[model samples]
Target: MGGFFGAALKRDCVEDVFFGTDYHSHLGTRRGGMAFYSPENGFQRGIHSIENSPFRTKFEKELAGMSGNIGIGCISDTDPQPILLRSKLGRIAVCNIGIINNAEELCNEFYDSRLASFETMTSSKVNSSAIIGALIAQKDSFAEGIRYAQERVEGTMSLLILTEDGIIAARDKFGRLPIVIGESEDGYCVSFESFAFQKLGYKTRRELLPAEIVRITADKIEVLGEGNPDALRICTFLWTYYGYPNSVYEGVTVETMRTRNGEIMAEYDIQNGTLPDVDYVCGVPDSGVPHAIGYANRSGIPFARPFIKYTPTWPRSFMPQSQEMRNKVAKMKLIPVHELIEGKKLLFVDDSIVRGTQMRETVEFLYENGAKEVHMRSACPPIMFGCKYLNFSRSTSELDLIARRIIHEYEGEEGVKYIREYSDSKTERGKRLRDEICRRLKLTSLEFQFLDGTVKAVGLPECKLCTYCWSGKQD
Candidate 1:
């Protein structure tokens, strides 16, 4: 839900950090921040709300004044960070990406009742990044503090700490997220997305192992600590949806994997004789387009864009303060072509259907434009469970998901026991589930990619990928 970039370069690195952090705008839309340390300026830090504007526009004015050879920046969906803190380790700036589900538990155990206190947000909840900083300061050294913080935080934690001399980068304990290093002629860099650095003339160095902690300076990267490599469980959803088209994680490119996923879906549909006879194969805008392209390529169907999203002025559809405003913005962004929809049978491939509200509205819009038929395909399997390892906002509660809501409608609370069966397309429950969704959304047809197919599309062993949102497997 958030991403970070850090630079320890030979020259004043503010410009590189600015552009590098801007590249991660696709990963988050809430807050943007940067922290730098110069002997002349000390730690120059800036944080701003980017809810209504792009990260670049919000930070452009300050970029010219802030100068430092060592700096870090972040695009976050949660609390403002690269927050400055003073502790036993000295004055430092800290920023983190990932959730801390057990913040209260950790505070109760370690935080001194009378002496220790936290800065709270409007909701009175301590900012997760600040909590992480507090936890890290509790230890004697950066390496030990990072290890302690990773162990104590129940959810996920991948962070960057800005020091006067260098930056400390730590990957998630289970490698659920990513921390990659890049090499340039001047120095080195660290980023969540590899492409962020590649564009800035930084060559791929190496990705940090699970729980790997390293100190990155202008000349070299020093390894501080590392956990077991076999504990890798990278989030598989990145390839299907959240990750940028150009981003690569664990040797797999997001766009390529998505295309492969679509091809696999088409292959299975043809074998089952479920491939719809449509005039064109289309995709929901943005992330869904690649999957649709692959489907079209494999099914021998022509790919067409029936509608285009107008994004020059509009922010992300989900950026609005309220759900009603967000839904309206989503529809407002689409400029439909009547010729593509009128009297045509169209099949659409969407990255994945989580809540189903937008997809339902999309189907209705097509029919209103005189679509003869509309069939839908989800590139990934049904999300049977909400994610637990990160600060993911797509589905907060189990009931927030449409699939879970439907299961409850039919079988009540006991439906929880058969979640696996409901996700299985060949099962009776799964068939009923699809039929019900179609009836509600008024779709001519609907099919979700199977679990095995998703894994195959990623080209990674199932054990290495985290399909927790679909399979609900903790390990």
Candidate 2:
């Protein structure tokens, strides 16, 4: 979903904050903001709509006029943030990264108690950061307020608060997201991505524990609270899809995991004697490229770039509001090589098949360019439920997922009971589900990575990971 970066430096920290936050640009597409605190100028903050432009281009000119040594910034998919608030906790600027399922209820509770009211956004929705700030303000100290907010929110929340002294960083209660600290001679930095601070000449200090809270300054890092190690449930999709290639979380790099996952998938196919007869193996561009390389290396197949993403004009496809528009942009970005696709049996690896609409369109595009047969391999299992911990998808209903829709068609209301069976490709229900998806998308064949294979690829114990989207088991 979203990412944040904060720096507490002995010298001017604006430059570090600017670039550190820019490193997280790929995480969110809606709003970008930065707030700085200095004794000379007080808190100087800027928020911009990055729906059309990148973070650097939008904030470059404004950086020259602003300066501070302690700051916090974020790239948000939800509300505009780095919301400045003056409460009993003092003048602190806060930015949040997480969803709040009980936002409306919380807002009503505040309203009924006459404690506070929130500023609404374009959709008349209360800004989550503001609500969080109010919740934090209810307590006596920053640590207490943070714990109070963490205890009340149903969904995940990891935040950074900027004060005159330094910045306070808090990871989510369940460790659903990550917050890492980096150290340098000048000061300390906190970020959602480890690589963000690494690029700023800072060494990796350590990642904050689940539900841990810390206060950072130019000289020292003080732990305000410790998290529960046994309650960790980090989102597994971060490695499979959302995380940046250079970034590492839970000691696992995203690109490395993807490559391993692809290798595992290929190994399974080879063992089962189901390796496809294909002229070339290709990825779905960008994120899927590394996975395909691993597959090619394992299977002794040639990896080719049959199509390249034309990002000169349309940098991000998700920036568009409507699904139809997004789909159009996605098609327009792919510049296919007819020489490779013409009269060739091509196998493609994608991160995951969500709604299947875009994958179907991509397959049709290949056929239009004279592809003989197209086989699809999904790097992860089919998503059976919507993500509750993060704002990963825009689907409002479970039926919005293609797998759920198919399950509904096959078994009506009773199909929900067989989600595990449908996820297991070896089972009869799973085989039928795969066949229907392939038939609908006009693909020659389809295969998805197994849950065990995915866990093995991640190099983590199954109990430590969150597989709710695939298994619907929150605990």
Please report, in order, the local distance difference test score of every candidate based on alpha carbons: 0.91, 0.92
Off by over 4 Å in 2: none
- The RMSD of every model to the true structure, in order and in angstroms, is 1.1, 0.8
lDDT of 1 by residue, 6-56 (tens): 999999999999999999998888899999999999999999998899999
Q: Clashing pairs in model 1? A: none
After superposition, candidate 1 runs with Cα above 4 Å error: 110-115
TM-score against native, each model: 0.98, 0.99
Clashes of each: 0, 0
**Deviation in angstroms for 71 in model 1?**
0.3
Measured with C-alpha atoms, the lDDT of residue 123 in candidate 2 is 100
